[model samples]
Target: MKCKILPPKVLYHPVLPYKQLTSDNTHKLLFGLCRTCMNKISFKCKHIDDPTLNKHDKIHEIKRCKECKNIKNEKCIHSNEERVIVGTWSTIEIDKAIEKGYKLQKIYELEHFEKTSTDIFKLYVDTFMKYKQEASGCKCDPKYCKPDCENDKECKTKIQYIIDNAAYNLDIDKVKHNSGLRFIAKICLNNLWGHFGMRDNFTQKEYCFTLEHITKIVFNEKYKDISTMILDENIVLTEYKEKEEYSKPNPSVNVYIALFTTAHARLKLYELLDILQERVLYMDTDSCIYNDDGSEACKK
Candidate 1:
């Protein structure tokens, strides 16, 4: 969406203060957090080039092999367009944990772990709690959060009331259970980082290309080096190249910051899932599929 220059009497600072995130630091921080205390972990890959050849080359990334362990550090050194193979594990329940389960352990192990801040999602409950705190006067900035609850009086009052009265927050502080706040927080979390929507100021060609090609560019730049995945259809590179009307770089829409938030959100999901001791099957950016009876205890 494009911002219009309103006459000065309208809302000042309608947008939140922007924060910057360096890609390298974010990669290390997020991967580090996800690697701690993982149980039932395993890894399996058919091929690796060699670990000692290149420090930045992750082609030889191997986790369980003692000889391959030295070069796994590159997994945390991502560029703006680098792809990371993030490994996640499920903390199974007592019944599932004793099933004599066996799995491999060839993961590209993490280098370190770091503490997360309030601006991130630590499951729905923590996000709801943070939202409540923000509504009641906690920090609200792009560095850690995007909710406008701190600024809107009505929204603030409503969330605080929910926090004060809700039993879900009292249920040993788990987000896997049910509550109105958790429901709303889950919705907010799912849609927190929408696509970098198009700007209205673009010409027709630029608009079309932005929608059709920008995602392709980023995806290809990240995955082009990895040979294991098959590229069935070649992307037509020059299909849309129009002479463009140049606009100044908008500092607020930096992709790196968006990527950083997404990484933390991912860590938040893993943290929430592993803590709840559920059988985590799979996870996308905003969703996870785990073994549950579809009750309040199963939802995350």
Candidate 2:
């Protein structure tokens, strides 16, 4: 979703909506979904600790609990605690939650969300697809070849073919069972977002052998959270992170891409869960377990 947020008045967090699913024993069929949704929502208040604040302003205020000193109580929403949801939720789901006394409060209308294409994973997906296609070319029959097919170049085995064409961490047994291809496909499908969203300011390490080097690292104005370990009388190990201003931007890191990818995926899973409803038995990031009573819900 595209919308402007007034800073200080609005805070954002990256979270998947599927994580909010209940862990009770009411779930049923095991099914998988793949897709996404993008949204930005603002909610009004539900439970407030203070009784004197104006109603409209109180809606935006989060209350810390007296007993737990937290804004939320997972086991139950106490009379004194209050919070506003910070992620996506469907209109139907919100209504049901409110009907069941869930702390949904009031959800504002979303502006708009739509799909567009990009070349983010084009190279990786295309390369693997080509490798998979070429690997499937060998007929595995000597009769099909004119001279008994002994040359690895002419009739390459799947392992030799992939190893020569792709730099994959292949499992030999799984390759025999054709699962290696699936594993590689899964990595291509999922790991791209993680790579694109990797944190840029990760802790960096330096090994120092002299007091000057140690002092130089410890006193660097561009770094923070300096930690040191004396390896010996002459050796020291130091770890620290570059200050935000000094940190370099990662060329591949685009948090918006990562967020939208997972958001769409959660919406896809939610669609299936809506169909399964009371039959859903278990839940995972991209899949679910539920009951199948010959109703052919899976056909949907």
Candidate 3:
């Protein structure tokens, strides 16, 4: 037999066409689609320790983050602890939410009880990540005592684990958190919400050169932390009464105002359209259109 190749007079895939993505198929779409876009940068990054940031670096161009395997170099990218996602839903989905015993409520940016200088972002994330005992040098292994171990929750090893975790507090010397944990805590405390308040989107668009700059200048001069070297600062709410307008606005107390304000604005837009009260077909974190006109959604 001679080698040969023949072109089909008519050619097409014989496989069954996939399900048409509709308001009812969100779960399937999420599972089937690759979320490569998640890695692309849409916002800026801010530094936690350096209040002396540059205004020019604020509006830098978009690039993919380190989390994206496809990104090149990836060295200049900055990552953060928490992010705010603003979403929208179609009217039918809004109706479904009511059928499922849910109603949208006003979402507020997180406010903590700690003073703005306290780095609450770090405090909570550290506690929540269960990093307390890992850096204590106690040499205890979690595999030795899982939470669901045969021993009652009061085993001696577990007791030692508890004591080991309680040995250090960031606020005190004797009681300590793991040193590595503390390092992570420091990053989160400083950068999490601060990223939101920044004015530049090049990396993190913090409100640079504003009253925050003044606060850092003042606090770094007056403060003393024997255990930590935080560049403690103020978030003044008093009106800027200066004869000259500030080069940038003064910061609200340690606020990621951009983060929360953007979210609130999204909610306000959703409400203005009365999206929930009407018949909607879908919902997405930021956008919900009546139809998906993409190739997959249009597949026969």
Clashes of 3: 31
The residue ranges of model 3 lying beyond 4 angstroms of the native Cα positions read 1-156, 159-190, 198-300
For each candidate, what TM-score against the reference?
0.25, 0.50, 0.18
lDDT tens digits, residues 43-118, model 3? 2333222445454442231122233333422332232211112234333333433443333443334334454443
TM-score of 1: 0.25
Give all candidates' CA lDDT scores.
Answer: 0.37, 0.53, 0.36
lDDT of 1 at 273: 62
**Tens-place lDDT digits, model 1, residues 45-113:** 335656465754554354345543443333333322222112333222111212322222234432333
Top TM-score prediction, candidate number: 2
Model 2 C-alpha lDDT per residue in residues 136-253, reported as the tens digit of each score: 3344543454333434455547446654665554333333323456467666756777887788999999999999999999999999999999999989999999999999999989
* Candidate 3: Cα lDDT at 263: 44
lDDT of 2 at 15: 24
Q: Can you rank all candidates by lDDT, best first?
A: 2, 1, 3
Model 2 local distance difference test score: 0.53
User: lDDT score of model 3?
Assistant: 0.36
